[model samples]
Target: MGTGWLPWSAASLASGAVLLVLAALTLPPTSEVGQVVGTVRREDAAWLMASAAFFLASVALTMGLPAILTLIPAKQQVVGLVGVWIWSIGTIGTSALAAFLILFRATVRVIDISPTDVEQLGQDPVMTLSLLFVFGAFYLGELVVALVLLLASRLPRWIPALLLVHIAAAPVNHLLPEQLQGVQAVVLGGGLMALAVRSTEAWAALRAPATR
Candidate 1:
């Protein structure tokens, strides 16, 4: 492989890292000490700025996968379109997460943390739909894409397993309370890292002279 693949993969990995941070930041509620989610009020210009950065980087990272496939050799791109759709699911998932923040906002909105609001927070209709949009697409799409890639002999073994694990974990995590979401966030973060690094592993394996 050319040195250009090095920079290409590096850029992809670097972008994935930044996007992972955004995913974690915006995914779970961050406590002041224990488990307090930060407010998303536009009153604080700083929060707005941070939110912008998080969404942009996350979306860019989601959208960037298509471009990345283009950079790779045609031989490696058999299931790449499906891969792009699969990656776009990240944007959907994180967007759902941002929308889920609205439930927390509603909690903070009331004069009292009413039982209704508390219950509602546990089961937000809007965020539920959002989660369905992303998690569903990603979940089903990953399986299909993985199967296709596998049949086509275009994907590494770890890629499908890693994605399947993440896809399966998503629904269970969404059922958790906002505070309990951090655990899910951590799981998702690790999953993303696993998917991101698979390419590097494949490259390394191929580079060994005995294989060649």
Candidate 2:
């Protein structure tokens, strides 16, 4: 059981790391806001498409975490499962948003739309609402998962602590230097990888015959 989940968790973490790197690299520069159309064009549609793909992959991988948790001898499995479900919802919402944004960008590039049109699109109520939902779901899910992990004791002490710090720092993350923003994703991916390895080991030990 643990062996089966390890691959999924590792893949999820890897995909998340790639998505973070792509976001940091491909995001439009702050100075380019006035030139929205140019900024949109400046972004590589391939990168956006890749990000969407990774986002979906990460979401799929997350589903396996709860199953892995169920194997652990812990009383708080329900809490952890709830967190996983919440995170899944957020990841799915964000994945859809990522896909939609990619398609929208491709359409804009194909039509060679002007900055004014881009601005108008941004102002559209539906777009604004979608953006809100995406961000809201993503963050809320992250927070819940972090809290559950912290309490569940299934993961290492440091893993949940790091995740909590990452979540708590969200509001001020932008205040830090631009280069530091991507560090969170790296830390998260590493933590997930570690969790996967640990889970695999635990499962192996449980399955092993007693030496005596």
| TM-score of decoy 1 | 0.54
Q: What RMSD does model 2 have?
A: 3.5
- Residues 1-212 of candidate 2 have per-residue lDDT tens digits of 23556555545545554555455445544433357566566766654755565566556545545434643445766666666667666666756766776776778768967767767887899988987876676667666666766666767788767666766776777776766766665666555555556655665675577543
Q: Which segments of model 1 are wrong by more than 4 Å?
A: 1-14, 21-57, 67-79, 86-93, 99-103, 106-115, 121-127, 149-156, 171-212
The candidate that achieves the highest lDDT relative to the unseen native structure: 2
**Whole-structure CA lDDT of model 1:** 0.52
Weakest ten-residue segment in model 1 by summed lDDT: 33-42
| Tens digits of lDDT, candidate 1, 70-148 | 3334664666666667756755575555544444555455544544545555587875676677756655655654554
Cα lDDT, model 2, residue 103? 76
Give the Å error, residue 126, model 2: 2.3
